[model samples]
Target: MALVEVKVPDIGDFKDVAVIELLVKPGDRVAVDQSLITVESDKASMEIPSSHAGVVRELKVAQGDKVSEGSVIALLEAQGAAAAAPSAAPAAPAVVEVAAPAPVVAPAPVAAPPAAVAAATAPAAGASDVGAHDPTRPPVGLPHASPSVRKLARELGVPLEEVRGSGPKGRITVEDVQAFTRAVMAGEQTTRAQAARAPQGGGDGAALGLLPWPKVDFAKFGPIERQAMSRIKKISGANLMRNAVMIPAVTNHDDADITELEAFRLQLNKEHEKSGVKVTMLAFLIKACVAALQKFPEFNSSIDVEGGGDALILKRYWHIGFAADTPNGLVVPVIKNADQKGILQISQELAELAKKAREGKLSPAEMSGATFTISSLGGIGGRYFTPIINAPEVAILGVCKARMEPVWDGQQFVPRLMLPLSLTWDHRVIDGAAAARFNAYLGQILADFRRVLL
Candidate 1:
């Protein structure tokens, strides 16, 4: 009898994906290439296969554990079977196939944040990172949480110590903070942590100045199927809730004349057809946004710890994220330094990233670090949409399908392609005047690409 360690094969570019399910337990027989544990990346979920045929001695990985290439998955009893030694990085990576539960893709966590945009980069320290940005917070000793988790707690006004940790080593996760808020909103003050923020004049103080969510069973009304949301939708749903609830968002809708811009795009596609690069209107939008951000730097800023939640974090560099709709769910893939790239390059990168997004192959680095965001329903066709602002980033630009309509060009009526623009900004940091100016300037750029040059 030989005891051999079962390690995760090369997962390729996925250095730290969550183990969502364990397919085998101790004493279970596993054949070579048999799926062992399921790990989920932010966009796609895959099953890790066993490298050897053996009886499982002990499971080394657990659900919710983060595993990477060569991470031990289990210990196996080889039973005198001769198995080739596994390489440090296997020549062929673990196959990325959707498991039985269906592939998971949350809107952001559980970011899997646009809190992950902040939290994913945060230090998983044992102590709270709250004191760094929040000067006027409560005096209670800090709880063990990542900086992003602390940020979510501060925004929701939740006491971290009160929320139970479900992560490894009792680390408070973003979901924990969200769950605490949901509990309070449901009129269940299971703990006294929220007492400090309780409304002064309240009815019995049973809940946090809110009514509980009504529990419902929809089956009585019609036929129902219990469909699970992709892991992306769950994570993003949490991220969107945090941002939408915390930020004082305001939307301003306007239209851009993209008749000439559309013509230019068509021309670019014709010229680049030989090179296999097709230009999209989003490329022009990205460039136009870069110009608008330059003209109104505050639109590219974030509300932060500098002013004790009253200040702005002005980003000098421009990184723009665009919402991409996938069969799984909606994901935002970003373009770094839009100001540095041309229309052709942006379009090329856009194609590559969008392909990766559609294939569920986008990495975290490609999705995070967006200073601003754009959500376009152009291809899908919509007049206007109010997009939620991604946290840390104060503004989002929403674009809709362009339509041709008669316009009064001073003397006569002319057909012009009108592209609807919706600019949503955090009212706390940006006033109505600034939001209007940002949208107006953006329209001006789309109307004439020459404005981007100046």
Candidate 2:
């Protein structure tokens, strides 16, 4: 039987997407087009499907490892029966031998530092002589561990070689990696000791200049259980950190009188209830934002990274992304051509996308190409929040609960519904005056929907 290498398919412009889950293991029979692993970018999560029907021989990449298109993800032993089918089967590629050994030792409990853990768990590109970022060739010896253990190590950033395995025949276990990381972070292990275990300059997260994360044994205080972060959090966290650090953000808070808008929305909802198209505040918000964006084209632009951040790419069309909360985490599903969409159409699509997001069914295309974003906390009852601007979009609007407030009208105070709005923008592109004007304009449009025509 011929062995074939399975690679990642075309996943669009994203690079270095993290492998989040493995769908198959060695000895498992996989059919053509079956998912082999799930990889997640900051925008969306997708599964890599198998191109050939075969038995899983070995997985090449582990969860937490960043991969690009064409990166080998697994090796498969091609099934002979698959060749006889009418469909054109993928041709076998070069063969790579994978060592299969049964575990001989039981893993013991342990903990370690994040970088050391990543080093210990993630496979190096080369042996002791290889540089961390070298791309010349493959590493000499692969680490020994199940895919799940390898994944855990990658998440923790532990080098498998540095971690001492307590499992049979010195097989590394999750506890061993954790113990190693704790020792490294707590300064129990010297720099020399860490260097000896893994090819060391420093661990993965070492360049941040931040002090080592404090290690705490929560069980010492009370009953405790460790739950791993969801894949969405792991992927989105990095993007959030980057956006927060690289972008100089400024947030402006304002209020919009939505009493009339709310009444109109309710009337529309009541009228359309039988039509099955429900009206939502978000739909109106989306339309109002589109009007503001049209008035201020600079707010509908992104910093062109390839242009050394000196140029802006102003989108001619309006595509808005709304943050949707799900069981997994927050995901932004973009509504394309929002400028051309009516309130009812936008509301229907928003509901559909939100449903898909909650169900984890949103595709990568549905999550990309947002010219601007809105994070609404109205349903959850928050007053205001500084929403991190979704790069490379320059601005994001945060919406909060609407409340009845006393408004001064001429000589009398009257009750009106006021909606809180928090507009956060990149200071590099938008100054305080522009941001203030943008917010004021957005508020005006929301207060009186007819203003959108101007």
Candidate 3:
């Protein structure tokens, strides 16, 4: 058979990319164009696809191996009549009849459980059936679930086996986990109630008729040891420190009158129900930011060195990045051409990108080339926070919790929905006056909610 060595192809403008994954193993058959390995560079990630259909004979590289162009990655035995043909030579005289090729043997069948045992071990109501929970399935967990659900289970030390599946095809879903959490919380509450109902007796109870505190031993214990920060944690910690030290962050706290915006979002949600796009205040903010960026292009610019001095590099296209927190770390995935997309399209794209990010499925391309960034902590209650500017970007905006505030209306006080906006900019690229002007424009856009749609 013909053996071919698979070498790394010419990856554009990149040298020494770390291999993140190997898709094939020795003796495995692979089709043409199937991905053989994945490489991650500082700028982006790409997969190397096989050039021909063949059986993998040897894999030369493993995960985390730094490779360059023309590096041999694997060896393959090509499939075809020509590759399988024996080398040409003088024919030998036949001595006797040749035996037919041995019959191909089938794989051993899995042993089935006894009938009585099978009946006894039948799954409970709403539980996965036997053999349905295959351990050899994809390493990734079930689909269409939120990250918080998985995190909650791990934190609470809840085993997946004890939880009932409510999603499609007996798959465990977020709602199911949340339900289990609620049950656990209720059980704790009941335990507290029972403890409160128990009769109190002790020195404190005899003196003041109140419940007595339980005694505890303060014996010597083993010393606690601290470990060094992980590589990813160290990087995150350094980035946070750099942002606080270098970026001139100023918090201009103001509330936006979002009553009209809220109504408009609800109306749009009804109109776009068929598209499965839920209109949100964040989408409106994005549109308003895009408009403001167009008017004040300086806010959409980046800092670059020129002539021994820093220069502001103005970008023509608007790529707004959304900060997504994953299990491993924080990742900002950019949404390209935010200025060109409508509210519905923006919402849909944001939802999909956020889902992918939380699942660690976002590629490096999605994490790079952001001209601006927006971080929203409004979902969790907070008045305002001075968010750090993402490096290379001139400006970053933070949206805080929107709440009802009492305001003076000429004659009387009135309650109105107000949202806080915080902005941080690079002082090297943008001056205080320019930053204030940009913030003022953003505030005005947010105040004039109808203008966002136009």
Candidate 4:
């Protein structure tokens, strides 16, 4: 059996990052997208997934070793059923396709994964000649394509430089690459420049007329040490940048009275002390948010941009995602079907997910498919702060620490524990009046949670 070399996917702008953890060894069988190793940059870490499935024949890199895009991560010996096409007659096809040059020698998907992950690895048939993947000769000045699109390009044996991006900012998409692969299989002649067409100055960035990012050499003034930015930080930073720059966001700050609710939480904690279930305010918040979402369905909805940006996707199910702080970087692990879970159950799951996040063991699936998000800085003190909306999600609730404040009850001021709520919403999806009403309704729920029954 022939062995397939599994190479590292693009880690966006960074290079030669240290491989901090090894997830598999020789003789171990692995599946597609199963994390092969965890690589650490300066401040945080991220896992690199395997592109092919098979028995691990050999290991190419070691812990503490540096890796970059196109670097081979492992040697996989393909397994049963789907392992014959690419390894068969490798030399004859190369000799026959010599007259018309194809830069990438995309081979058959010798170990195709299940239908769920098939789109990411399955190569288009009759696309190109079978040969060794050339890591050094990547097409120069290739336009930007996401990791997923790049993965598909590698599987299809199509050079990204030769694929035109039909998406915004001349970004290449999976569909665009698929179309280009069909063209290549038909032996269509096209120039590289023609294949990578785009509007000048990009429709989005040109209007800003932004200046170049500052480049400073601090070493000239004092001694300094350089470190690579952590993988998680880099990934999250990109998302944060996109959310901050693109979204028309507005933050509405209001306070919720939770004095009575706090007392109830303490009483429940005492009753469940023997069972090891410690109820917290967040659990109650989740329940209240669900009820509030039911009251105002728009808050539980996402923008329908792909369907011509004319509607909202009101989700029938409620899955709440809460921000969990970790040593590496911030990650949000969602509690699926949160509407059906009780306060104790939600609290236990929150503790479990937070533990996994701190250990850097949370899977990508655990952090995805969130309809709404809550970023709480209650443990750590803060009055109010705006949280960037997680894309597709139109709103995020930012919870700050509670404080005892004076509230006027008719003629006299009384001390009350007020929980600050900073609700940041997309102005395009929600207006000021609706946001105010949402906060007021949520405040009412916290003041007397029995309103949820109503």
Candidate 5:
């Protein structure tokens, strides 16, 4: 089979499932078992992975579409034998039709000799071919199209530049290129400006309208050694970049007087010292956050972009995730149901979760399903710093070093331990006034542990 229609796989006991997200778009190359879409039913949300490695030719379902078992989700150009075999002669003409948009040589005929099999199966191989992906090419400056679209464009002899993009931010969609080809074939007056301003694969920074990323030889000035980043950093870097760029984030800075709270914590530890569970500040913070979440439910909700980007999914359960610094990188271990647990229980759970995180033994379930997160740098001695909001959760609390500073108590200055709080939130979900109030209320709760009871 040259092309395959990817259908919804066996989803036990679910029907008319709403698509929550589309992970792969038309023209993207996908690996076997790679997630293509996320569907949410009443019971749970699950990702649908590709069963075959191939290039996505067309998306049959979009976000918010209700799909059932055997529903065609996408069309794919199967890789390897399914795509290259001479026995697939029946679909050769259709394959040729899809390739009409690209400027590539034709595949060998069905009756070609065995010696030409490899050449027939191989994709076009011109380094300058816009459809032929050049590994050395700087991917940033080139026209945006999926791998399948580029392949189709190559087959159709359509330079992507001549086709005006109708997709988001001048992105060339498959339809756009196909329409351009139709116009050209109909003998309509179409300008071939693409040939004049052709993208030079790796060297065309002018296409993206941005300065090229500076490449430097640091070894020339000083001795340098190359070291690979840790697995956690490498993975988290991409997520951090996407979140930072996409989210309109705002950080509200505040100070919490933990003078009395710290003393109470020490007393609690002294009281439970023999119990083998020491109460930590993070436990109290978790409890305080849960309380705040209950009071301000909006802060505990996620904007459902999959649901048309206008709805918020309010979570009733409070699962607090705390950032743990391991030798590898930062990891967050969520304490499920922090709202139901006492300080001692929360502290014990946090300790176990932190231990598991440090050992890299934390399960996926342990790290997921968090309603809120806290990143504390109090141990490392930072005054204040903005923390990135972990997506799906609208906010993150960043705690910094607590220092004993003199405070004017109406008449005299008294030394009080002030813990710095940096609350970062998505501006789309939270206003400045609301964020300020939240930070203030959090500080108030920390200043007087009694407020938690009230």
Candidate 6:
């Protein structure tokens, strides 16, 4: 039997991935392609599969251990050639045993309870008991604990019922169980005073003072400590800062007359309810942008070369990315072939992508490949703000809050829903006039709400 070491495969551009789960253990038999461990990066989670059909001999990594490409994950004992091959064996015949008949006995009938017999003979109660237990009684194992305590207990693998409380009404304090656990693990006598006075570390805190506290002296300390940037954050930060510095970004503010667009959204929503698609203003905006791009193909194009070798690269297909805020950081999940998808389809896809992103479930594929981007802070309070262009994409459209503002009509000022559009574009490729023209065309399309529905 040959023992083969299973090392981590090359995941593109990812390093120091943390092992999140161990799918198999030592001595367990695993088939080829069966998952051995699961690792998670900031962008996505992936499973490492067994390279060969064998028994797991050892696991080199544990949960929370940071790993990189070519890191040894486990050792597998290869199955013998004889074990791998199938044997052609005959089946065994079934045998039946015969038994002799014995003396027969008459069985006695069971006597029913007097109350039950009376109930069957007479009328039943308004609500018969029928062997039912009382509904008013609380269910078993349901402890009287606060939600916070329950959450902590679940995280710490501590049973709430087993923990002795020190708070009001027998409430469990976080420190109480943590101290108990430390004492037990250390094999030390559990003293109430010592447990209570155990230093609460790990979190950031300062010492209390009787008078005014002295300020921290940075001069007394050596060199400051610096944390390495995460892969996603590092990329995002560098790209954003580079875009800001390199691009002469300009913004154009405009409002779409979405009265008819709103009505159309409501109408489409009624028809698409069974399909589970929601028609929102953003859906219409995406459609409008796509249509406008088709009319002004230059806007969809990118400036490939600067100065000496000046040329524009016009993309044939539209892959618009939507910036999604995740727990880890901001991620831009692309919507491929946006020009081909209808408003309803776009809405459904966007919803799914947003849901996955927020849940930290977006795959790495979903977070890459974009020709353009759209970022909306309309859900928040901002009216308008310049958005940084995502790298490789020439421009990013920013959507701000839509508010009811008085606008002057032909006769008088009327309250209309106004949406702010802030477009930031890379100056290396796109000229100011071209950018203004692109924004103007998009504005016109949005203002003509009937065009969007059609």
Superior candidate under TM-score, 2 versus 3: 2
lDDT of each: 0.73, 0.73, 0.64, 0.72, 0.72, 0.64
- Per-residue lDDT of model 4, residues 80-153, tens digit only: 54643333211110001111122223345454424323534444233333222222444423244544455445
lDDT tens per residue, model 1, 203-313: 111123343223355788999988889988877876786678867899999999999999989988998889988889999999999999999999888766443354577
Query: In candidate 2, which residue ranges exceed 4 Å CA deviation?
Result: 1-206
Worst ten-residue run, lDDT, model 4? 91-100
- Model 2, range 1-454, lDDT digits (tens) per residue? 7798888766767689888777678887665555677676544456676776778899999879999888998898887654322335332211111222322232364564333244346543333533222123443233444444554566555566556554432344455555555454333432333434543111122223333234455788999877889999988876786577657898999999999999999999999999999989999999999999999999999876544456788999999999999999999999999999899999999989999999999999999999999999966798888999998799999999999999999999999999999999998899999989999999999889999777
**TM-score for candidate 2:** 0.59
Off by over 4 Å in 3: 1-232
Q: Give the number of colliding residue pairs in candidate 3.
A: 0
Task: Give the CA lDDT, 0 to 100, for residue 116 in model 1.
Answer: 21
How far off is residue 28 in model 6, in Å?
Answer: 38
The 10-residue segment of model 2 with minimum total lDDT is 91-100
lDDT of 5 by residue, 166-195 (tens): 433334655555456544433332333433
For model 5, how big is the CA root-mean-square deviation? 16.7
The segments of candidate 4 whose C-alpha lies over 4 angstroms from its true place after superposition are 1-207, 221-223
**Per-residue alpha-carbon lDDT of model 3 for 361-425, expressed as tens digits?**
88888888888899987578887888888865778998988888897979988887788888887
The TM-score, computed over Cα atoms with residue i paired to residue i, of candidate 5 is 0.59
For candidate 3, what is the TM-score?
A: 0.49
Model 2 root mean square deviation, Cα atoms: 15.3
Clashes of 6: 0
Q: Which stretches of model 6 miss by more than 4 angstroms?
A: 1-231, 305-309, 452-454
Q: Report the alpha-carbon TM-score of model 1 versus the true structure.
A: 0.61
Estimate the Cα RMSD of every predicted model relative to the unseen true structure: 15.2, 15.3, 26.4, 13.6, 16.7, 29.4
